[model samples]
Target chain A: MDSTVTTATNESVWGGGNQPLGASYGKLMMWFFLVSDALTFSGFLASYGFSRFKFIETWPIAELVFTHVPFFHGDYPLYYVAFMTFILIMSSVTMVLAVDAGHKMQQTRVIWYLFLTIIGGAIFVGSQAWEWSTFIRGDYGALETKGGRILQFVKADTGERAALADFAKNIPSEREDLQRDKGLWFQSEGYLTSRSVDEVVEGFVANPNILIRTETINDDNHKTVLTREESLKRIKDAAHVVEGANLIHNEYGSRLFADFFFFITGFHGFHVFSGVMINIIIFFNVILGTYERRGHYEMVEKIGLYWHFVDLVWVFVFTFFYLV
Target chain B: MAHAHKLEIFRGLLKFKTNVQKIWAVLVFLTIVTTIEVALGIIKPQALTHSHFLGMKVLNWIFITLTLVKAYYIAWDFMHLRDEKNSLRRAIVWTPIFLVLYLIFILLFEADYIYNVFKFGFVKWNF
Candidate 1:
């Protein structure tokens, strides 16, 4: 009877069915999804490379632009980002250990490892939020001129950041209610009255203390920020001084590069968030002995694939975004 | 008895019981290497900056080399690629190798071309 059963199974195993890619159905689907996701990421990164190429001359240096931190300011270059990378890498390690525990049928071990992985992921996401906030709230603000150029200001003595109000000769005394409407149309909910271009220029001309200069009018080597005296000499230089990094133009740093950096890293952060959720579900299952009763922990292996993919993407991200 | 010998051989090769210890060792090594890389990157000595290798900066080469080493350990030990069949291993590894190389080559070359255009183009980017 056993021999007959073995023969029957052998015939079915050799039979030509429309099986996918010589892999199990689940693994095949996972591969297909990964391929599409990879293409999407590639498209974003390629567009970034193209934009970087287009603005090759005045692109922001990655190290200098992302160097600042809150409270502990002054040239803290790449340290925080490196720490974030380590957190993600360590999470990947925990994920692998979880999978190994699952393979050994050690349910408690799986739970502990998964728990650690989730914590690591949460920390990474938090770090990313801090990074984004630092970027949006720029250290130095600049004024946008009519010709789409950015004009930035600095202190005369210490060369620290000078506020936009410091450059204003006549600070607008009449507080215009942004919500007040001239016509029948109601004002926009989020509308705020920003200082106008003419107002900025008038303020600059009026205030003898505030100096206006373009970003490109640096000293010969372009390594150091221009001094107030040097800035006065190069005022006629046709460089746009812009305040902060934005989608349209980044005067505080490289505009195109910043756009790509946010988009790519933001997508990866979304992936980490999803991975954490999946790991949570798996963690609960491990605690309940669901896999123990089922005789194997293949679920852990599947999720491990996803966790590793996140780590792999981060490896590339660290290289391009930070190291390069 | 013969099957028991085969089992012992497998156990010896895998070192399954000590896998956890090995994982910790790899993690510690990776941390040390990363710290060293960051230190070197921050210091960025003048001599290293002046040197070039294979049309790239020496510092960049060091980064690439260290990254490859990290990748090797991650793939081989953590992912158990070392225990897998050579064909399966190559299939997984070679694809990324070729793709990444192609991407770096095209992007860097185009970047240099664009740099040239900016340096000599009639249209000034700053203007």
Candidate 2:
């Protein structure tokens, strides 16, 4: 019975013969898993789109938000992300090469390609961690209004963004942070911002060259800058000084934007991390001649499929988050 | 046993001599597309931004189209879907493409409607 089931007879494929689709059980299952995984990612991206559309009028521009590089910094937008994109693509290339070499039963070539692919994935994941850190530690602080709108500052003369440290006054005041040990057991809060709202308002009033840029986008597709009088009036509505992005507050613009950024990118980064781990396991297997003993390297091919799926997801993430 | 790969891309308009060469060719194509995307994003030509096609900026449409092109090559070549049986390929590809399209369409349409309600309705925004 087992031999009959395993044998490929000349029967119609619709008769449920062996390997009807010409794919092994493991490979076919992997394809199905990938298809489902693709839908999950699409769901996240579509929800991101929904939130972006809901906040269309005040959606933060991706170029302005992601302008920082690691070492050299003077407003280089999209360069670091582009490099990351290249690295992921290069890793995908190496993964496919490993798979190809596996087909020819070339263990040494497979090992080298897998090693390169692992290095590339590590670099990409490290870059993502760095990007998240910078985003969490925002460059310029902003004011959050009672209505939860962000108000960034700009130099009236140059129209460049003004950091809170640049103009905030050194007003002497006693501000204490809530601590679990020092405060009520049930009431603990995060650390205080660098400067208080009163200090920021005073600094703005003292500096005549400062202007307030609202989150609202005007007809010219830029943030609406208020006049000096309007700036002063708007400053009074500020309830807190927001330094960076979190689930609740975002210095970039809408809180939902930061939420989606963290959720989607964090999810993708986790996928890369796992892919690297799986690749490392496969790398050791190749080094130990495990596939040679098995008389096949289909394991490498399976993992290659997974690694390529990761890169495929990144292509969409980069497009939706950065370019579009 | 090693299986043969479909070496040509772009509907057989271009062909490669070997599987390795085909993979490299696809990589070059992906890189070029990415470069174009980054350039267009940075440059953002005024004409493209000003013009609207199908309710989106022309630049965005270009980006999406190029993205799909890249995705096609990545799937067909890198994932070896091109070497799979037609039934297997369709099972893997068509299922997600159809479902994702439906999902995106319904969600985006509903989102646009909600945006209008927030924009013009009596309910205040960010409320």
Candidate 3:
């Protein structure tokens, strides 16, 4: 078909045209991919919204969840996430600069800016990994009720949140650590919690200062703090003492929150990782005079489009997941 | 090599003499918007937090609006959508908006119904 005589010209709309929309084939394809990728992300976030809205009263608060800073960890809510957003935006700025340099055929400027963008992406991926670990290894542990609700403890007098380590009883019961020899068929239990349900319930009863805070949000927009008698009553229904978040359980609140948090952010993190790798390849290609010989720097511009798309998705993620 | 569009933003609301200058201008605007979002999130003034609008917190409405503003500028300025042809711009932008909005609306409404079932029905509120 390509070698045969053609009736339609390159400018024609149905002639397998390259510029019907005044965009190159590659650029248009990249945009199309971005549109679909965006839809995938929207699906994930929408489901997250569904679960969050359904459990609106008990959904984990972002401010309380993402409170740790890199070096300093003292109730610095949204500080690190704000920093991550800033870095991503700044990387977008650098990517734009690289594209502008490519347009001008300034190879050196394009290389430098691309290098900066790669660095920014690297930093973001690193921070996201650290965040994942922090989330998995939760800070203050809680008791998982039989009905799947979390019961965190707070100071009755000060109203400050308390950690499991602070009040869990150091019980020296005959709880044997199962090994291969002790097991009937060599099947072993998973990682055991530091504090058993009995250990936690016993400690809660002994400590008069510790009060139970249910995951439910009251009219005041804060978690419901139960009375002293209610705390004792609630602990009796404790099924297990959950230490950290996994696919099934979370010490913080709803398991759906952790599920979405892991899936959405993990997908975004993978995108950033692949983007950096692509940028690196393109950076070397620029240095090796590949684009210079090809007579256009469109490759750099293509990668730039991808980089900005990553940044754009983060804007929504930051808003819906963290802020809203 | 010489022909890149003139450096301006916001439909010429802001003008920059150099491409570098334009990049910094966009960065500054993005920074300002992000700062406002972070400030509002942290301070969370009582009035915005306590009130309800559209069945959600007014503060959340504010956050979502500002985030859209940030996304707009990133796509428009940083990604150079502003400098592209009209047809190209529409092709890239229009397809996602309709689908995403429709999807989100349907899912969220379903979530509300499920929430009621959890609340008043046989399913206990917690467990």
> TM-score, each model?
0.79, 0.95, 0.94
Q: lDDT of each model, Cα atoms only?
A: 0.66, 0.90, 0.87
Which of candidates 1 and 3 is the stronger one according to lDDT?
Answer: 3
RMSD of each: 5.9, 3.1, 3.5
Interface DockQ of each model: 0.23, 0.59, 0.58
- The list of candidate 1 runs beyond 4 A from truth reads A1-43, A69-74, A144-151, A154-170, A173-224, A227-230, A233-243, B1-17
lDDT of 2: 0.90
Model 1 Cα lDDT, one tens digit per residue, A1-324: 312122234446666543322334554455456546655676666666666665543555566568875568588887988898899889988987887787678888889999999999999989988888788666666765444545576665665556666664454555554554553476555423245444555665555566544545232313245555665444444234445565776656556676787789999999998999998998888899898998888777677767777776776677667775
Which has the higher DockQ value, candidate number 2 or candidate number 3? Answer: 2
Candidate 3 off by > 4 Å: A1-18, A181-186, B1-6
Q: Per-prediction TM-score of chain B?
A: 0.80, 0.94, 0.91
Which run of 10 residues does model 2 chain A get worst, by summed lDDT? A1-10
Candidate 3 lDDT, A188-266, residue by residue in tens? 8778898889888988999999999998888877889999999988888899888889999999899999999999999
For candidate 3, list the clashing residue pairs, or say none: A147-B127, A148-B127
Model 2 CA lDDT for position A163: 98
Docking class of 2: medium
Question: What TM-score does the predicted chain A of each candidate obtain versus native chain A?
Answer: 0.79, 0.94, 0.94
Please tell me which predicted candidate would have the highest lDDT against the true structure.
2
